[model samples]
Target: MLEIKNKLYNSKERKMQKLFNKYMGIKKFFRLKSEKIFPLNENEKILYTDKYDYKEKNEKNKSDKYLSFNKRIHILSVIPKNKIENFYYSFCNFVKKNPSKNEFSKIILDERLKKSILNYSNSLNLGGWSNLGYTTPKSKELENIVDYFHLFIFNLSEDYIGLDFTAILNKDFNHKLNEFMISEIKNEPNYCKYYVGNKRFISKTGLNKDIIRREKLDDILLEIKMRCYDFLNLYFDLFPLNNKAPITFDEYITNYEFNSKNDYLLRCYDFYIFEDKQISRDMDIIINHNDKEFSQTFLDLYLC
Candidate 1:
């Protein structure tokens, strides 16, 4: 049954749904197949690489801000080889259940939503008041209130495979409307290049700051900004203000290659590190962008 809001958003909702459904359906089918092909006796393990860094501004910098050394601990989750099928379906369901484009766009930019998601992710060192355009010393209650809402698009990975942006896809998928939409994600002018990693279903649970330390969660915070950049990239692909030819994702990437400090840059994990034993409960570390030595050190302890 269509609700009143559904009626209002029907055109866009249907359009987005149609384009994405095929991708979702196909992905769902394969994920289910992966079950028998790759059996699993337990919940999956997720591996991811994300860095977080911040600067304490001094002299010679143009803007008044600096990147923090606090890292994001870029986490990826998997449910188990046996659960891939179920995980993908859950992810697709979330996409279909996603709020209308208008709703998502508006909520994402809202300061209230920002505080809710950020604080829920972690409370320490959220920077000064007004840093996120809100009054300082926000109450946890205010943050939890929006827990009932969806603040962004998420993909829940199942099993041991680390499904991430690095997954393989076409050289460029602008031809596919869903890919086109994804291409619109805003990215910094100089963030690292992203190639098609793989096709996988994904979803998100709210961030658990307790599980991830403030020093590490900071990197996760930055990854959130990178995703915001991803959205802009797709949006620009669909709508361009320039009279001349609109740029491609590659072009946008090229433009920002060296100018990430500008607002146009996508924020990402750049600083901080954490030992694996501190966080892993049966969780294992697989891929990490941090130095191999550091990763190995963590891995060694995790094994011990």
Candidate 2:
């Protein structure tokens, strides 16, 4: 555990290093390999641990509870290292903001959140948003929604960079992300007036109900952004392709199969290069033995 911490600390991923340094207990949890089921304090019950004599216990009794639990823990252990890191940071950040047991339990049990985080972790393990060359329509749509929402928050409030657009959309507008777009834009004036609007959206007069609501919203947005960025920063660290070397020509040919060369694939292929001299030599040998004309055309199109 200490070795892993030291390695991560020296690596370029500072966010992950800081997370590990701040929450060393998590490292202990992951590293535990005991084979005994121990009791917790008298007041605590249902404390799950991976250390249980599953084989002996299952043979002694007909029950497979210990065996099942141990299997689940083993499965968790096999989760990609990056995903576990991301899950830890996300869990910690969520706990810091909402400490109540009920709140924490609700989030853990949320199926959508779990699935989304897992999918995101898988993407990070691969290459993240930029490396996703040609995605399905649904994925493309979600990315567009999130990206445009960020842009909308900036444009709506004259480049205000403090609000948590993701949280607001997740909590209040999960099913209707575009809800506020048309309504908010309706109040905007001609081009020049937009540059001189007040920082606060609502008025502060009379009972000042709108002002209080705006202030409260701002505070919630700020809190949400804090958690979101904390998760994002940690996830960015776990994203393996964040600062990876460009894909070599041989690697590109061996790994990926392009059915049709669309503009997006063309753009991505252009980014792939032969940095390693050996890989470049191997690619030339393969190209010579294969369809030379096709290879020449592909190189002409994408090779830098």
Please tell me which predicted candidate would have the highest TM-score against the true structure. Answer: 1
TM-score of 2: 0.17
- Which 10 successive residues of model 2 have the least lDDT summed? 67-76
Q: What TM-score would each prediction reach against the true structure?
A: 0.20, 0.17
Give the residue spans of candidate 2 off by over 4 A.
1-168, 171-207, 237-304
> How many clashing pairs in candidate 1?
57
Question: Per-residue CA lDDT of candidate 1, range 175-239, in tens?
Answer: 23122222223211111112456744442122222222322332322333233223323322222
Worst 10 residues of 1 by lDDT: 246-255
